[model samples]
Target: MELFARSEKTRVVEEIGGVARLGELVRELGGRRVLLVTDPGIVAAGHVERGEAALRAAGLVVERFADVHENPTTADVARGLAVARDFGPDLLVGFGGGSPIDVAKGVNFRVSCGGEMSDYRGRATATASLLPLVAVPTTAGTGTEVQSFALIADAATHQKMACGDPSAAPKIALLDAELTLTLPPFVTACTGLDAIGHAVESAVTKPRTTVSAHYARAAFEVLAANFPRVVDVPTDLAARAGMLRGAALAGLAIEHSMLGAAHSLANPLTVRHALPHGQAVGTMLPYVVRFNATLEPATRQTYAALARSGGFADAHAPDEQATEALATVLIRFLRLAGLPVDLKPLGLDERALRALAGEAAEQWTAQFNPTPVDPSAFERLLNSAS
Candidate 1:
């Protein structure tokens, strides 16, 4: 076995009605002046107002930055940093989905450390101390609240950049399913699949460790078991809570083990076709799984275990059989959730596919996949997805 460094740390402050407790937590953190990073959609959904009320109720000063986009760009981060600096916030609050949380992480790094985003492009690049951050997720996907990395897009090129550092991790993550009840069924379905993708990608990455595998497997089980249930019964609180927990666990797993080609490919699809991240990634995952399973029998077995643990059929089957069965299950799930199943269906043509595959092959995450992936393999995968 290879000796490796492990930095394990996560603090999730969870409750059935976390919104009601937000005021107390803010007061305890001694955050008199705070920067709240979010999007307009969240404001429209009333999450922003609710969070604002809670913070103000705690006798804290709040400055809002709600201009974040879906695939947050460098400009978005810059704008957010300006807000943070102008407000001189002692603490930061990330409210909403992954984009807002990711934006907040970027703001923390740039404001406190003073550097270009590209300077901290790779993993663990933070050399400066950062202010405390609290994350409140309104959606159940991306698990960005628990991660030390932020995925920000380049403003001009629209290319996603993965910036990571231990200092970027939030001090507290508040998980409350009540906030997710307003999510549309399709958004719920898409984000749930994103959680599944994170778990699967983590399980088979080259640096996969025992701890990452444990979290990834557990996340997969929860996502697989609860995703369809939530899609079928969107108001089921128990199922929503399960999906939220799964997303958080998946985030933790990816924070340690990183991810694989599915995300690598999915990023370009979002940049090129303007498809939602989760929908694009969900479409590419089945093909990536089948491709990876061809070279890694043990990985396939692990996936089989995940499927069985989630109560999916064919768990006891042979590795190849189980892999295929899992693929089928995923396809069915996507269909049931009303998501696109192929690149063509998502308005991606062969010309776009060729370009996207080439770009995906160059992504940093591709280097960490358990099985080697080249441009030719990526082209083949794209074709299969189409």
Candidate 2:
């Protein structure tokens, strides 16, 4: 089924300090036992303690799985699954960033359905109903909370596997923008860029629908207005709120409309260069935009609409002019965020670039690009960026 068409009883609540109300929410969902999944960073940040207090105060049993790493792998999921089995929780609370939230979902899939993550690659593959999940995201990036996909990687090969199912989508997304205030500037920049890339890429994918486009445009408008503010001044609460809401909206876009070449291209760079996902996507996005703009007039028109949505160009501007405007603005964002805009600075050579291009072509998202992409198109994009 199409993602937005699914009839899950999902709830989204926006509260500035909603983590403190987790206990109340869990009770409303009929959760007597809770497994709280998170990484060590969030524990150190003290968000976990507050959530634990709330759940405990509400008289719920809770367990902790705190070993998730960035780009969580199969090993990470297996380790988390062990904790879930020991606790036998009736519900899950994913209390950190995307990694922990995804780890929680991964654990739920295996524990409830009795299989590895690969068995549930596409939508609605779960053999049993998964545990109810309440996601309290601590960062403004990744946007995995609102979507059903769990982006776990293979431990040996580092190939990202997007495991998705309708039953695996979060039952509640509890937003509290104040939790984002403690992030370091670089984490803030990288995650914010990831959200921005989601808005831009989902706007023009081949299967984009009217509902998804509405979310993409709304996400782009808010992200474009707030990203720079948060990057330049991390303590700006208003900008932080805008970013959190924008990321969630973008997550909804990716839910209904899968992403495009930028995400497909970004994954290879991340696995090969050990680059952060946001930095990889940010560096390659402008080049992909320029490459896609030449595909056809309709694609060019879509890019133009995105440019106008960001206030980077006038509504009446020609498609070619607005397309370039969007590409230029993307590069400017790289400069503003202090991220590399090309592959040369990363020390990747022609051979390495060629290998990455080949891997990029095999990614699931590549086929969703409005223009059909092969290794040759990816090679051209990488070479130009380099």
Candidate 3:
């Protein structure tokens, strides 16, 4: 395993109201033509108008592409690409949640590199210089603002693709808690739970490193302590700040170590059931945790420490006991966020488990799981969750 790694750090300007400084930050990139890519919901929230106001105030020529859809497909990327072509932007600003941000990167790939999304599925496939992106995340999930990889699905097949490149990473991440304040309660729960999944999965991946371990542990701590506060009181600015920080750290952790079985498992569920990403991931996380913990003594200890760091386990508990407690707490998180903990409620019975397992075993992140996960193993986990 390669133990050495480095990240192209995104310049983070985090504050209670940092979006107001977005134009100033992007001006540092020296681009006069800016195309802001976002979704209608964020437009409805008025964050796009605020971002436009800031960019225009800084003497930049701004164009808007605000029709992004959830789980952005190549179709969404192509639409944004057509807008990018017509507008000819020197800079791209992703001004919403993960979907919009991923679309911006997908558009960047096409407009800069001149190929389909499949052409850039793996890491560092882009051979052309890409436009700089300023990501202003409106949700405390996916942490797309801090990541180089864009999770775009295929328009026809519905397969989610993880396209990564060193240059595709955001140049600046403007995290404003005020921007996240308008996320409705269910959106809050779904996104926050996804961040929690990022923290948990990255901590114990087979390739996890010292640097990733630092990010994973810190992310888990902050996300664990703050997820409930934001869930209970949507207007709690302090909790939103903590969640934003935690999600960013989780994104960095994912950059270094990647994700694990939980994310892999979630993808198939999301594709098949149209379950929200976070809800699908959160529902199966505890089962994946239990499956991973028992694979090796070292991995068990690692999960135990991660759980203890989040105060979900006793300091002196046995590794297995602590890991069990961790799994239980993960289940508790799903419930706290008003998300489902199993597949039963969605009306999928045991018959649906076999095919889902096959698809899950094929996910890109599945290879990085500490335990070598085969379809049978995934089937077992799915059966357990069901």
Candidate 3 — worst ten consecutive residues by lDDT sum?
A: 1-10
Candidate 2, 27: how far from true, in Å?
A: 1.2
Q: How many residue-pair clashes does candidate 1 contain?
A: 0
Candidate 2 structure, TM-score to reference: 0.96
Residue-level lDDT tens digits of model 1 in 1-386: 11111344447876767887777787777778889999999999988888899888888899999999987889999999888878899899999999999999999889988988877787788878887889999888898888888989888877678898887888788888988999998899889989999998999899988888888988888888888899999999989888888899899888879889998898888777787888877888899989998888877887777667666655457767777777888888889898778877666677877898899999888999888998888999998977
Query: Over 4 Å off in model 2, which ranges?
Result: 1-9
Any runs in candidate 1 off by more than 4 Å, and if so which? Answer: 1-8, 346-350
TM-score of each: 0.94, 0.96, 0.96
Off by over 4 Å in 3: 1-7
Q: Candidate 2: minimum summed lDDT over ten consecutive residues — where?
A: 1-10
Cα displacement (angstroms), candidate 3, residue 166, comes to 0.3
Measured over all alpha carbons after superposition, the RMSD of each candidate to the real structure, in angstroms, is: 3.0, 2.3, 2.5
Model 2 lDDT tens row, 1-386:
33233453357777898888999999999999999999999999988999999999999988989999987998998998998888899999888889999999899899899988888777888898889999999888888888898988888877778898977888898989888999999989889989989988999999999878887888888998999899999999889988988888899888889898988888888777888888888888999888989976888898899899889999899999999999998888889998877878888788998999999999999998989999999999999988
